[model samples]
Target: MKLNYKEDWPLYLIVLGVITMIAKEAVEVVLTPSKKMTSETNKNEWHQPSLYLDNELKGADREMVLYGENLIANTSYYFGPHGTIQPITNGMNCQNCHLQAGARAWGNNYDAVFATYPKLRDRSGKLETIASRVNDCFERSLNGKAIDTSSKEMQAIVAYITWLGHTVKKGDKPPGSGITQLPYLNRAADPGKGAVVYAEKCQTCHGNHGEGVAEGSGYGYTYPPLWGDHSYNTGAGLFRISRFAGYIKDNMPFNQASHQSPALTDEEAWDVAAFVNSQPRPVKDISHDWPDISKKPVDHPFGPYADGFSEQEHKYGPFQPIADARKVK
Candidate 1:
């Protein structure tokens, strides 16, 4: 039998308050000591991790955040290239990139978005709002058109991101917030070497051709395509070996890999990234990106660089030299 706090007013207030707090912070259940829960850098500091609860929320605000959560978790259904609400993506779910709806640690989670956003991004060299960031994903990652900032869908998404990051203090770098920075390889990673790794480790889920398995009769992907017309455009973050290598190293092969215990070694990760990136995919002109070439990452994979490095050198490794030269200047 449930404990009836019906007549116990004080107990009712206590439980209600607890529920309210739970609703606001959505990630408490799986929080570990290693996670920087309170902006602390200590390896095992104490702090609560939170993931908001939707059932406890009431009325319109609750409805909005919940809808936003749904969009993030089920992006293909609502806004995919063939989605019912709007067809603006390459049929990939947002969760394909932001694992566990942006709740999981080091899974490209949004723990830092709310805390660090409305700030300057060197890529554009402008202060970007959350909406612009979302649109960037639309234009590049999804290979589609931008959703209107004034639209309800955009508002809902922003609301969800805001809720996910509500517990984080502004400017606090929550531990394991984003993908880890993997070490750059001394020699350029080789796509030829990568093919073997992909055949051995990746072909099962991503298909022999990287076309990805379908979820149902629909176009949604069970495992997203690594490279193709339907995959992320060349302008996407994953197009860069540095970015993609770090991503796959942290999480890949379904249930096998993680940020700490990646199934692939650093070289394997880097090479496999090269192999995947070498495949033909849709292209989008990013000539206007990184308006200040001096600030561009060494692996941007495009030209007119501040450093006179070859495009091949930029795409491949030995990136530290370029990185070092930029630092000196």
Candidate 2:
């Protein structure tokens, strides 16, 4: 009442404290880790079966499984799945070109690939979207025609790749997971030995000096330039011996029906990578997202489709909390 307004101060203070407590909890709930526990678990489960099946196969069945898995894994690169265009060089799958998701020393890998998609690709000065990015590989990498952006096969391949991308944090460089160890440069692999391997396994498509063949008149290079001026820029990954070795070990050559395709040992892959890198390539600035190079998650590496983190969070963060690997069961 009129007793004293000052005497009501403590009551007001208590009310303010209650309001603050509620607001804090509400914020916590809204910003709590986007629990993707199920998504992560599914990935682990999927990989286990593939590994187990691989271990169990024998004889022709083993060969069949390897071929099938190679096809499934590299569908985008070879079959023009995922809106790819090319399909001529080896008549094989993406695994054939990429070699186990590109595990060879100078091969391409799909890991940490999220950060590079949705890129502004310059195809003969024309700006292309991510769908076009997929198509470019079809045209150039597989020597096939591109797929329609809306195709189911393209969507499936994208889904598979997106699933794989989720294993690493976005923006980080791959740690050369599939790479093999090699001797020091002083004890470097004999490029002579590498030359023999290349002629027998690589020359058909990649050409004698790794100068990829010419497709139609002025179409993309039939075989991608391995180390020459037209090949990947000096700073564009394949320059790294380890990454190149990893790619060759996993993927390579044209025919992957037999693991005997590349037929190169880890040391062999490393030597080849060394030989290739030692060759001439244009030294250029290969721009990439830098500093915050965390492993990218699957799904979109950027844009509205990405999960958990906001564009700002994805770009700069308190990154997404590492899924509790221990909690995965």
Candidate 3:
């Protein structure tokens, strides 16, 4: 059959396009590795590892893991003022900060803890063991004394964290290992603006004064406090406005938000963080912190910095200037 070249051109082009697409896909399949291998290469990709206890662990190890999970989920029950084990920490569970016993993606999960500990940390300016790191949280975040490293509770917690990150290679930080790093705002975060946002969005769960709702039993908080004696101390990591802002940007207003669909804008997050941290909380003697003042984070919120910036500027920042200065140095 004699086909008219001009009239039949559209049909020929459509057929050629379809074949090209098929060929391209075929070539890609041949050239690219499988999904698993690609995921291994890009370790940051979300691979929601199951919390279900694996068949690999047996007997005492299994018991320890379960206990650790319980401890993380209900830390206040064992360490609060009315604790059955030891009345040490303010009545807030570890899960309040770590989220889902440190399993939730970008909710400050311990996905990289096992893989990355025994590494140098700028906060203390020392190579810290996982046990030392855990103790740091106890002292600062929980506003409590450090549990003995040899204690069963400490060992169990380490075991659980290790179990969570067992699959990840050493020094590899999986995506969503910690809170999302929100970008620095150009202007200083305003506490006044944040107060409004808190009243509208956060007050119901966290209370008007940031005193979280107490659990019915009065042992722990159902919603952890953001400030005051009961909350994380001034030396805590979240005391840093940037860390708190990043955390809030990724997860806040309870279950209404997530990293994939954050409820607040970067500006709102930063402002809210500023407001929250500006409120009074427990004061830790951080005289020993950041042995090398030059290595101190721009957002550390304390004085005696290598830079001439005031503590106010450090706490509620247009932080890029500090960052830029550091780069120049």
Superposing all C-alpha atoms, what RMSD in Å does each candidate have to the true structure? 13.3, 21.6, 5.6
Q: How accurate locally, in lDDT, is each candidate?
A: 0.83, 0.49, 0.88
Judged by whole-model lDDT over C-alpha atoms, candidate 3 comes out at 0.88
- Candidate 1 residue-wise lDDT, 1-329, digit = tens: 56666667788898899998997676654564446443354453212244354455578877787788888888889888679988888988877888877777778778789999999999889999999999999888889889899999899999888877877889986667877788888899899999999999999999899998878948578898888878899999888898888878878877789765678899998999999999999999898899998887899888888787889999987798888888888
Model 2 residue runs over 4 Å out of place are: 1-186, 217-222, 257-262, 286-329
Better of 1 and 3 by lDDT: 3
Where model 3 places Cα greater than 4 Å from the true spot, the runs are 1-44, 51-53
From the highest TM-score down, the ranking of the candidates is 3, 1, 2
Instruction: Name the better of 2 and 3 by TM-score.
Output: 3
Model 1 error, position 161 (Å): 0.6
For residues 125-234, write the lDDT of model 2, one tens digit per residue.
Answer: 44444456555555444445567678655554554444345455655644432343333332434456666667777778787777777445343444566866445544
RMSD of 3: 5.6
- In order of appearance, the predictions have TM-scores of 0.83, 0.38, 0.86
Best by lDDT, which number?
A: 3
Ranking by lDDT: 3, 1, 2
**Range of the 10 consecutive residues with the lowest summed lDDT in candidate 1:** 44-53
Q: List the residue pairs that clash in candidate 1.
A: 25-51, 25-52, 26-50, 26-51, 26-52, 27-50, 27-51, 28-50
